[model samples]
Target: MISKLNLENILFLDIETVPETAHYSDLDPTKQALWDAKSRYQRKEEYSAEEFYDRAGIWAEFGKIVCISVGYIKMEGEVRQFRVTSFYGDEVKILNDFKTLLNTHYQEQKYLLCAHNGKEFDFPYIARRMIIHHIELPNKLDLFGKKPWEVPHLDTLELWKFGDYKTYTSLKLLTNVLGIPSPKDDIDGSEVYDVYYKTKEIERIVVYCEKDTIAVAQIFLRLRGDQLLQEHEIIHV
Candidate 1:
């Protein structure tokens, strides 16, 4: 299936999320209690809910997406150009804009959404957030009645798993093995919350998200036994 895919038909994407609020105290008392109960097992007495709030972005219920960067391959003359664009700011606005992009350009059976660990994280997170915001799910994202094989999505992390369900691979590690440049040179996922809430540098997060999307595309290409894209070949749209 990987080899048969048309690269241009796949929209490769990555998302950046932060806790719903800058501090745990910012949440209402009711939400604070809910968070405390929700994180009990994960915290395991090592950290309180307030201390663990930094990691809230991983959970769809307590976090909001700040950026959704997407890229698609385009053939230009003799080069393969990967074009990237991002929808960011106010979670609802970001989600609405992203849905617009999907409705406008990717509303086709042949089009597929690709991401690293997307099935578990990015894909569901987007769907859950959309529901929270009362936004309609795009055809590609709404997976209610579709058969397993009919789902039009690709996950690089799932591809690397190769049926070994016990092991997990980070995009950084996979890209390193595949000889793709590291997308973490500036800041890693852990620092995104700080950069967003403290520095207010959403553009930096957007750049990071775009690089991850590009890396996902490059990794897919490498898995297909194709050459990795050159820096000059990536076009930011």
Candidate 2:
């Protein structure tokens, strides 16, 4: 049970991704054939394997992570004030800043990094990029292939399993079921790449990332016993 676990030292994190476009067309013959087949489906308004690469590259390019919003609640007197700090910047710089914060500020803290669907996507994506940028990853994120429950990592998605492997749920769906108000408005996951390309407004992306982090935190509180964030854990960039 999370109650048996210490909650005071936990940190929440979320990241945004776009398609990978660096020399996408330079695929080997076999991959090129596969790409061509997938492109045919995309032309037919069906799924596109190429879209996956394209999307990843898009995020890799103009997708400035812009903000890494963090939330934590510290006990304050009779009231708890939620503190949310949004670290913002270009992809390279922002990632570097996050690494510094994780190492310097969050290192000594016995806190768990929480996120939604972090196991399948967000965690690995961030780790790979950090490696590419030559930045050291926090110990929390280093648990890549470990069993779901074995590592110190806590994924709300995995928790949602509740010992049921067949019950797959999305953050949006869980929030709705739990009555957690959705913070999304201007942009969504699909529009993220387009918004960055059209307006180059990293704020929108940042806000989206903020909402995701909040959703993860909300899920954590919900699972912990219907307790919403107590203010200090809410950081506004």
Candidate 3:
């Protein structure tokens, strides 16, 4: 199925998010209560709401995107090359820049957005944040009345599932099994909050995000039984 689609038409991407505030105490009393109630089921007796606050970034309501890195394949002198770029900093600006990129370059039926576990996490999270910022939904991301078949989003995780809904696979694990370079070499998702709030090194996070985006593209190529890209073939813009 992947071989039937044009790889050049797909926009491969990934996003990094952090808690809206550095600490749980930073939220107002009402919001603190809401976070506790919202996360009670997942936390249970294992940890207090404050203890689990580090994970707030997983929930769109309590998080903001710090970086959204995207990549695509192009041809250069009969050789396939991959190019990547990132939008970082303020959540609103990051989202706005991503939306503009989508509208400007990929606003066609043939263009598809691809990411790892994107259907459940990256895709919905971006849309919710855009709504919170009062930004109009980009054509590719908006799925209001579209039929299920019309959604132009591709998920590497879903493709790997192959109709087995009970199993779960992390991108790191899949990439490892497929022999793609590890994207988690610098930092894993668990430490993103600390890296953002305490260290204030967003550039580091953006680099990590771009690595994941590149890995997603490479994994897709592996799935299609194609050659993995050589390091020299990757261009960071």
Which one wins by lDDT: 1 or 3? 3
Q: Rank the candidates by TM-score, best first.
A: 3, 1, 2
**Backbone clash count for every predicted candidate, in the order shown:** 0, 23, 0
Residue 17, model 1: lDDT of: 94
**Runs off by more than 4 Å, candidate 3:** none
lDDT of each: 0.95, 0.68, 0.95
lDDT computed for candidate 2: 0.68
How far in Å is the alpha carbon of 103 misplaced in model 1? Answer: 0.8
> Model 1: per-residue lDDT, tens digit, 11-70?
999999999999999999999999999999999999999999999999999999999999
| TM-score, cand. 3 | 0.99
TM-score of each: 0.98, 0.79, 0.99
Off by over 4 Å in 2: 20-54, 57-66, 144-150, 230-237
Per-residue lDDT over 27-135 for candidate 2, one digit per residue giving the tens place of the 0 to 100 score: 6667657655655644455545554554543223222354567766566665654556666656678788777777876776366777788777666777777777777
Best by lDDT: 3
Candidate 1 residue 48 Cα shift, in angstroms, is 0.7
Candidate achieving higher lDDT, 1 or 2:
1
